[model samples]
Target: MTRAFLLAATACLISQAAFAHAFLDRASPAVGSEVAGSPPALDLTYTEPVEPLFSTIQVTDASGGRVDQGTPKPLDGGHVLSVALKPLLPGVYTVEWHVTSVDTHKTEGHFTFTVKR
Candidate 1:
């Protein structure tokens, strides 16, 4: 009986940990979207609070040139990360992000958005 209880408790803990990592919940310019003009900054919302100091957010133009300025700031109770962006021309931009949750789990992803002329 003790062995069964231990196994069940371990499985529950493992399953909970699997979902504790932060994920991209939303973005200011949004994923795979087109905007009429340039946005001054990029805001990324995560599923959970993240550690800003250990997180990275990079924005690049079509030519793979970095366009993001300054460091990523954690806001909205650490559930959102924002970074300033340089003046963007009418083109596609890629956003790549890596974040570590307060729980110490790491997650990363990339998306693209376009600016229309």
Candidate 2:
């Protein structure tokens, strides 16, 4: 009975890891980085492929004004998300993202990057 319990526990742990929520793996312009100039767009990479239909990315300046051009677009089979940006002035920009992985797990996060004067 003890052996069966241990096996069941192990299987539970394995399943949890296998169906883990998707998280940010990387970002273009690099998270918390200062760029010499404005990037025309933003790229976000995730640990797993996400469902674009249920995912979102929003960008805002320090003043809380939305700067992202419009809806986010998924690329690279949904592992990467790209969003267009309006002309950015020298300042801090915050990017907020929420994604639902193909596995049906959902997660969200935010980061900031700066443009040099």
Tens-place lDDT digits, model 1, residues 1-117 = 999999999999998987899999999999999999999999999999999999999999999999999999989999999999999999999999999999999999999999999
Q: Could you give me the TM-score of model 2 versus the true structure? A: 0.87
Off by over 4 Å in 2: 1-19
> Per model, how many backbone clashes are there?
0, 0
lDDT of 2 by residue, 1-117 (tens): 999999999999998886688899999979999999889999999999999889999999999999999788889998999999999999999999999999899999999999999
lDDT of all predictions: 0.97, 0.93
Which 10-residue span in candidate 1 carries the lowest summed lDDT?
15-24
Clashing pairs in 1: none
- Candidates in order, TM-scores: namely 0.89, 0.87
**TM-score, cand. 1:** 0.89
For candidate 2, list the clashing residue pairs, or say none: none
